[model samples]
Target: MTAAPGPSRIVRYAMAVAWSSFLSAGVLEALVFAVVDPHELRWFGAAPVELSAEALYTLSFLIFWGVVALGASLALALVNLPADEPKPQRGSPGWPR
Candidate 1:
């Protein structure tokens, strides 16, 4: 018999990473960047930062999006992990084991 259809693995992974990137790089990091402009950034000993706003934003987006994507995919994988052993029915002989 044909099995019921469901989302393919790629579709599930893409959806997760896309949402994760949007929330991380688009929303959360955007809020933080708004409050902490690159021009206002400082280095050790109070030295002015060197990176331009564009470069900083790009770097931050990459880092945040990568982390969120990894986390999302890993979580999805873990959530779908198969059972190590078959579950025993309540009245089955294996149930006591």
Candidate 2:
């Protein structure tokens, strides 16, 4: 019997970021909405927003998800950096002669 192929490394990372961002956005939405009414939100704290409460919630959640995902992606990139290469000190033999 043939074994099923697993997800690629990129796919796995993407999924991880997506899931973490999803959960974070949900929690953020709940906490913020609990303390503030969407109708009271304004644009730049001056002009009134035209979006409905539901639209505001949806937009806010999406913004939160995007920001969280960006952070997660950057973290993953840092974590996945190549480990084999060592930086050469100024006077080390590995440094350019």
Candidate 3:
């Protein structure tokens, strides 16, 4: 049987939550990067030996927010999946009475 079609409140809520989390994380990331030393960013990965603080902050911001946004968007998309519907029996070719 075909599933019923309608707006999904759950999906909307999930998306809202995801975006809110992403925004909050982004703000926090910016604040932390503003004060942390660039040399301390090596934990992220190997890079050129002499990266500047501003460069490190920019890179960190991009990486942090990119991951946050991507992960949240995936979660929200998954939450938006339509509810499952039972299939009709083979002998029943029309809507149930």
Candidate 4:
């Protein structure tokens, strides 16, 4: 029988998903901000509402991509989890002799 995934494997899988999500979200956010309001380029300033129709379209695209990337990464991470292991017999020592 296959061994269950240890804590390290779980953490590694989670990290992979987290990193991918972070990078994809950051890129998408940047693209949306750049297209929506080029003047509001301040990294720490409040967003401005001076966006054109083209800018809105671009922003929508960015959001779509972000959602897709997030979903894909989560799905991949979930798939990497180890399959269920057989439960130990009740009223017995935990490990097999």
Candidate 5:
């Protein structure tokens, strides 16, 4: 029997980011909702939101997920950057001391 192939490096990273951000969003949603009611939410501090409580919760969670995903993506990008740049020769213009 042939074994299934594992996910590629980029796929693994994407999965990790998505899962971690999902968890973070859930936690943030719980914390925020614990102290605030969705019904009481205002839009731009002028008009009350028209969404139902369930819709509000869903929307808020998505927003949280997007923000957290963005942060995770940036961190992964930084961590995946090349560790070293190509060095110039000793006699080259960009050579170090």
Candidate 6:
């Protein structure tokens, strides 16, 4: 029989999903920013580098959603863990005895 995923594997899967959400959110925000106006902001403090107000706004939104998704997905992964799965051992018979 195949071995169930180990703790490290589950953690990796959770992290991968979290990072994927971060990247997907960033791309989505960029796409939305393309059609959005860049000057749609009130007077604000100096912006670091050459970023515009709209781009900064998009960045902030991306961070907020990304963190929220990461937390939710990680929690879901932890909560949905399989209960009492049988572990496969090395150099053993079909039953791993």
Across 2-95, the per-residue lDDT of candidate 2 in tens digits comes to 5686786688889999999999999999999999988787888998889999899999999999999999999998885554445446576853
- lDDT tens readout by residue for model 1, 17-52: 888676877776778887886888887749887998
Cα lDDT tens digits for candidate 4, 8-70 = 655766677667776776677667666655544434576655766567556656676668667
Ordered list by lDDT, greatest first: 5, 2, 1, 3, 6, 4
**Top candidate, metric lDDT:** 5
lDDT comparing candidate 1 with the true structure: 0.77
- For model 3, state the Cα shift of residue 25 in Å: 4.2
TM-score leader = 2
> What's the candidate order when arranged by decreasing TM-score?
2, 5, 1, 6, 3, 4
Q: Tens-digit lDDT track for model 3 on 1-97?
A: 7668665666766667667766767796878867865566554477544777777666767777667767777777676566657654777766664
Prediction 1 TM-score vs. true: 0.59
lDDT of 5 at 23: 100
Better of 3 and 4 by TM-score: 3
Candidate 5, residue 85: Cα displacement in angstroms equals 20
**lDDT, candidate 6, 4-41, per-residue tens:** 75667657776777777777777766776688655653
| lDDT (Cα atoms) of all candidates against the true structure | 0.77, 0.88, 0.68, 0.65, 0.90, 0.67
Q: Write the per-residue lDDT of candidate 5 for residues 1-97, one digit (tens) a residue.
A: 6568677668888999999999999999999999998888898899999999999999999999999999999999888554444544556665354
Pairs of colliding residues, candidate 5 = none
* Higher-ranked by lDDT: 1 or 6: 1
